[model samples]
Target: MEKAGLAEFNVKIVESCLVPPCLPSPRATLYLSNLDNQPLVRTDSNVLLVYEVCENVLPDPAKTIREALSKVLVYYYPVAGRLRKKEDGKLQVECTGEGVLFVEAMVDKSLSVLGDLDQLKPSFKQLLFRFPSNTAIEDVHPMVIQVNHFACGGFVVAVSFQHMVCDGRGVGQFLKGLGEMARGHVKPSIEPVWYRELLKPKNIPVHDLELTKEKIESTSDSWIPLIYKESTQMSLTLDFETVKYVKDGIMLECLDNCTTFEIVAALVWQARTRVLEIPHTQNVSIFFAVDVRRSFNPPLPNGYYGNGVVAIGAQAIAHDVINQPLSYLVNMIKKTKMSLTNEYLISIIDTDQFLLDIYSNQANIILSDWRWLGFNEVDFGSGSPVNICPIYWNENGPNISNGFVFVHSPKRKCDAFKVIVWMPPQEFNLLEIEIEAITNKYVVNGSNY
Candidate 1:
C-alpha cells in the first residue's frame, strides 16, 4: 500500500502490556554519570528492524521476544525503571522494578510492499507504539518495543528508549541479551555491570580544551523555527571498490593514512558546506559523538551499558572546508579523534557542561558512524535483521539543521557504506554531485525522499 510514494500500511495492535523482570532485581536508586545527563541523551531514540520471512520461522515471534525481554530486563533492570531528578537537579533512575512497554501488532501487507528498506519514509513511524501525549520524560517508560508481524510472515521490531539509559553499543549489548534468551539460554552470555561510579570525575585535574561546552535550549525556544526551512531525508551507498578508490586518491594527496569513516565524513562535511553556499568567512562546525570507552585507563568493563559517548566538534571556515582538498578535511577529523585522551574525557565530564548544542549551530552537520556499532549483530530465533536504521520524524517540526548517519550497505555490509542524510531538498541534490566527484565514481541514490 502506497500513497504519494510514501510507505503506507495499516498496523493493527493485537496486544499491549508492560513486562517486568522475570526474576527479582535490585530495587534501589542508580546514579547516572554526567555523560548520561547530557542534553543530547535527554530525548528518546527510536530504531526499526525489518526481518524478511524465513524458511524456518520460530513459533510466535512476538511471544518469544516478549518473554525474552522480561528475562533480559532482569539484567538490564535500570532500563525497566523510571528516571527521576535528585534534589541536586541531577537525573537518576529509581529502580522500582516497574517494567518496559511492549506491544504486538499485525501489518496488512508483506514487508516487500514497502519497497527498498534502505529508503526512509515518515510513515515508518506507524510501526512504533505511540507514547502518551504530553507525558513527561520521567513519567514515561524507560523503553518501548512494538513487534509488527506482516501478512507475508515477515516482521518488524520497533524500539524506542530514553537515550540517557545507554548509547548505541550499550543498546546493542542489551539487544544481544534478548537474542540469547530467545535462543533458550538461561541468561545472557555477558553479564551486565553498572559501574557508573568509575566514570565519575575523581580528584583529577580538569583541563579546558578547544571543545566548547554550551547550554542546550528546548525545541520551541531554539533557532530552528527562525531559520529552519524545508528538509528531506534520503540514503546513498558507496561500495567496496569505490571506497578503496577514494582512499587511494587521498593517499596521492597526503602521506597520512585515513579510515573509511574519516574520509567519508570529511567529504560529506565539505559537500554540505559547499551546497549551503555559506559565507566564505563564516565558521562551520562538524559535530560528532565519540565513544570514550577506550579512553579510560583500564577501559570500561565488557558489559558496562551506559552513555559512554561524548560529543566533539571540528571547525573551520566555510571557504577552507569547501576549497580544501578532501585530505585537508580528513586530517581535521583525524586530529579531532586523536584528541580523545583519558584526561580530556575526564575534563569534559568534570566541566559539568553539555558538549554541543546540535541544532543551535545553523551551519553545522552532525554525523554518526554506525557501521560497527553491533546493530548488525542483533538477532532473534528467525535470523538477523535484513535492515536496521534510526527513525526520524517531523513531529517537532524539523529541528535538525543537518544530520547524517554512516551505515553499512544492506547488500554488502562487510565492505560497503551507506550514508543517510537529512537536509534541504536542493542541497541534497547538489550533495549527490559533490559526493560523486569526491569518490570519482557514481553512487547509488535511493529514490525515496
Candidate 2:
C-alpha cells in the first residue's frame, strides 16, 4: 500500500453493462474535427473523482443517475455512438444509437485509507480507470463510466472517453450535466452544443510544412510501469503562493503581464530540458494549448462543445531557455499565444496533416492548461471531489510519451494546482531537484521552508 507511499485499491467490477441513450432517434453521426483525428492512435480520456458521504439519501446515486442520464442522452446522443475510420483512415463517430459502456463496482475500503488523495501517482491511477481492450473492434464506444463505492459510504466516479469525440472541456460539460440530473435538475443546466464542424480543416489542408517534422506513432507499450517494478509516471502539486512568487519574479524582469500557466509551463519546460541534460544548443520546444472558443470574431456558440483548443509551439535553443531570465521564457510562450489567428488555425488543420504524426523530439514538452475548465462543478448529490484527475495512459498504452504535463487546480477552493506529469524517472528526478532549488531560490525562501 506504500512505496512512493501510494495505497492500492481492491477493485472488483460487480456489474458491467451498457447505458444506451434513453430516447429513440434516427441513426446519427458527427464529423470529428481535424484536431481530434490527429492525436496519436487509441488515446482515450479517463478521469476519476472521489466524493465523501452525503447527508441526504433520496438523491441516491443509483436511482438518480440512471434516470437522469437516460434523458440526458436524448439530446447529447452522439456520446452513445462508436468511432469508425473511413478509407483515408480519418476518424468519425458513427452514431448508431449504440449504448455507452457503464460499470458498477466496489472497493471494500474507505476514502481516507488512500491518504494524500491530492497526489495519486500514475501507477495508482491505472487501478481506478480501465482502458479499452486492445483486441476490441476499431469502432469502439466513445464513453465508459465506472462507479465504485467504499466501505465508508464514500464513492468514486471513473469516466473514460475516446479523445477523438471530445476534448477536456467537453468532458467537463458532460459530467456536469450528468451531475445536475442526479441532483434532481429538469435537464442539463446549460444545453449541450455540437458545432464541431466549425473546427473542420480547409479542403486542401494548408500547413507550414517547413517548420513541421513528421513523427510516426510508436505501437509499443514500453511506457507502462509494471507492478512491483519502477514506475514511469510521477505527480506533484504546486500551491498558489509558490506559483505567484515565481510569476512575480519573472514580471519584475520588465515583462508586462504573464499568466500563471505561461510562467509555470516555462519553468517546467526549462527544468526538464536543462536537468535532463538535453544539448544546450539543441532547440527545445513547448506546445501550449489555447481555447479557440472565444478566439473567433463573433465567437463560437456559447454552448458549442467540441475540440475547441489548439496547441502552438514555442521553440528556442536550450541554452537561451536555461540562461535567459524567467521573463524571456514567459515572453516566448506569450508570443506563441498571441500569434493564434483564425487563418492560422485553419491553415494548420491541413498543415501537412501533421496532427497525425508522432512527436518524438527528445527535447519537446506538451502542456495543457485545465485550470479554467470547470471540473469542480461536477456535484452529483454529494459534494464535489476532494481530488479529481485525468488519466493519460490506460491498460492499452501511454497516450503520450515523457514530458507531457496536465496542469489543473486541486479544486476552486484552493489556488494550488496539482501538476501531473509523465516522464522518464531519471530525468524527472533531475527536474524535481531543479524545481526544489528554484522554488526555494525564487518560489519561496530557504529560511521560510
Q: Best-fitting candidate, measured by TM-score?
A: 1
> Which portions of model 2 show Cα errors greater than 4 Å?
1-5, 40-42, 57-60, 117-133, 201-230, 350-352, 355-358, 394-401, 404-415, 424-427, 443-449
Tens-digit per-residue lDDT, 162-212, candidate 1: 888888888888888888899889999989888788878675666566534
Minimal lDDT window, size 10, model 1: 215-224
Whole-model lDDT per candidate: 0.78, 0.67
- Let me know the TM-score candidate 2 reaches against the reference structure: 0.86
Candidate 2 C-alpha lDDT tens digits along 321-432: 8888767888988988887776566666656243333255545677776656667678887777766766656453444554455545544437667677765566567878
- Model 1, residue 90: distance off in Å is 1.5
| Alpha-carbon runs more than 4 Å astray in model 1 | 1-6, 130-133, 211-229, 394-399, 412-415, 441-449
Residue 131's lDDT within candidate 1 is 69
